[model samples]
Target: MRKDWQNLAPAHGLNALVENGTIENLEVKDHVANILETNGVDLNDVEGVIWSHWHFDHTGDPSTFPSSTKLIVGPGFSEVFTPGYPADKNGHCLESDFAGRELQEIDFSGSDVTIGRFKAFDYFRDGSFYILDAPGHTIGHINALARTNASPNPGFIHLGGDSVHHAAEIRPSEYLPLPESIEPSPVPKLHSNACPGHIFAPVLKDGSKTEHILEWQDPWAEFVEPKFGLIYNEKDLRETVRKDEELDANRDIFTFIAHDWSLKGVVDEFPKSLNGWKNKGWKETTRWLYLRDFQAAVV
Candidate 1:
């Protein structure tokens, strides 16, 4: 229904999962600093940089930010990634990123607040933002739940950092089942505006029937294997995804993963706030857009 193919591309073209790539090829035209500057935001005003985990891709060129900007990380981050790069020799991060800045690690052991089975830390005290301990992808991996509004019917945006790579990992659950028919097919070049959901049945995991998109016992049935085998704890990651599915099912919450290609053109970009997502109908539009990735298999 929405004709915005300008941002639509094959899943591979939009995928951020890189393996054994050179820095030159991986370089992007705009970094966080560039985006902030474009929006008339000064780097000096940024008080803190929160890292979901110490992964190379997630930790952008932090050295660009002003030293006054504190670098916040999850628990066990210091124990492992501290004394970065040259000093540690085998560290994943560079010392320059933390040289003159204060690197603060989040310790959730004392926090009693819990949100959707996760140990939460109210970053702003005012329920507006919360940092959740979501481990599995790596040690001290965390996710964020941001309250978009304060009204009686408030909406939340769950920033799922590497909790799951694709929407298929957490979608089509008991709470959000696949529709019998999908309108405005995700395949960009398709002439038909609607796609039958049964086409994807052939690609479902073994023993999974078309009756349900994904079963509780096997949620990742339609997901692809990770390009890089960097999962720190597969078992814990499964549990984290299970909890994520619950949050995704909540009508008021929008679960957005770091690498979700479905949201490319659907959600508003930075400079445009995602505050009124519910009113804008962002969830309904983008929820099933990931189905486009299966175009090759289904066709």
Candidate 2:
């Protein structure tokens, strides 16, 4: 796009790429309706949709839905982003998404209900689902927590909207150690959770000027650097990660980083509730699967 490119929002940027033949045959889809139709579910009954934050990827094509369907977001969302796109010109969202719908922003500032370290609000008031105060990736970034099961031991599914990008972000730590063995699926099942080899990164001595600097190497795992770091608040983001990792450590909670592609074949998709995750052993089965991604990086 030239200087005259009026719309540069995430979706528009991507669409422009395709339209200009810079990218071809890319699938621009209405995934929301497709999933509902495939599952024999009615799309009209959708009361509303909750966006984890204001980022475009999470904020899908809400304009495709009926105007009666409300738009829900986390705290500070409206204050920071509203009167979207054409209305504000600098806005990243489309006004059509919330044009005639109710906008519900979850404000946990004065809430008394605290789940673990997060000030939480039960969306259903049934203690089964909650919106967590997650901040770091972006302002008003929030995560969801759902009680998966009840019985001898309760289980939870943590919907990490965008807190951690890679498994390495919260893995191989004191709480969750690398597995000695794993068994994946397909054919005889992807057994032997082995890697091509390990890579080591040298710990450079600080301010080393001479060749006499000596330091041992440490095993390296690269977690994709977070794009927007603490534009919201460093203290709040660090606190969020601290609590998030604690949740990752607990065996009862299965944290799903929304963008981790390694989970494609591991967990259940939409329309199908994730309530049986414990019985399915999803947390353990997909724990070491991320290593599959690094297989291609080896020479």
Candidate 3:
């Protein structure tokens, strides 16, 4: 995305949804820039930036940094979306986005390693970070898993970009089962220690109902608006659901999706290290909170 401070609307809002609906007064900032400034890091200090997918939200503004900043993307990105925008006449990428930069397209096929349910590629080759093939939300979608703490027993911080949007998609799975209890979070503006899990079932068009994982009393079953319109292919979506269930089951992995509204203000912001997520009990506090969105389903 070009940093056109002049017409800031396009940079922030999803123009594709304008006809159906959109929100005004929404301004998307260059988060990469925000992180750099907050940490007192220079632009040139950034070695590279990898995108989980080619979506507008994930791509952000690579042009804002120096021409030297390497732009890394998942496989098939160039073939699927090269000669961007005006050049391709039908592409979603902007030519200026990759102009004069060292573009690296990573291929995860034929990899020998598998972490959890994902085929993993060790980024640093030192066991610190990895790029996992995470398809579903889009073509060539990927995710990152970083070993944040590694003393007695290692813990991971998973950057789950667009893999799953809601707790419903990631909850009650075999790997990460619902916790028995949770501590209250200050951000939700609540002062408390204990909150229980909320699980619900969905009614079918035939008027029959399917049971939830544990049949815990639930006021909300997952009902994402179909109008929001996703572009996930069959194979990708299937793999996504399969692997997400695995990731959700694992206790050591802290997976953060691209647009998890439940995470906002609940977790630490940038410039604050999330390295201690395990010690702080972030997963416990935020896990069942998405059930709050089910309020509409409750009578």
**Deviation in Å, model 2, residue 187 alpha carbon:** 16
Q: Candidate 2, residues 220-243: lDDT per residue as tens digits?
A: 113222322223454666567667
Better of 2 and 3 by TM-score: 3
Q: What is the lDDT of residue 235 in candidate 3?
A: 57
Q: Per-candidate TM vs. native?
A: 0.82, 0.75, 0.79
lDDT against the true structure, per candidate, is 0.74, 0.65, 0.65
Q: Candidate 1, residues 1-299: lDDT per residue as tens digits?
A: 00221121223222233332322344456567767888999999998988997655576667778999999898887887667766776555667668899998888998898889988999988898899988878778999999997778889999999888888888677666667777767765663777776677765655243222332233333464332234666787888888888889898999889989889888998899999899999988888788888788777
**Range of the 10 consecutive residues with the lowest summed lDDT in candidate 3:** 211-220
After TM-score superposition, what is the CA distance of residue 285 in candidate 1 from its true location, in Å?
A: 0.4
Using TM-score as the measure, what is the rank order of every candidate, best first?
1, 3, 2
The most accurate candidate by lDDT is 1
Model 2 TM-score, all chains together:
0.75
Model 3 clash pairs?
175-249, 176-248, 176-249
Error at 30, model 1, angstroms: 3.5
Comparing 1 and 2 on lDDT, the stronger one: 1
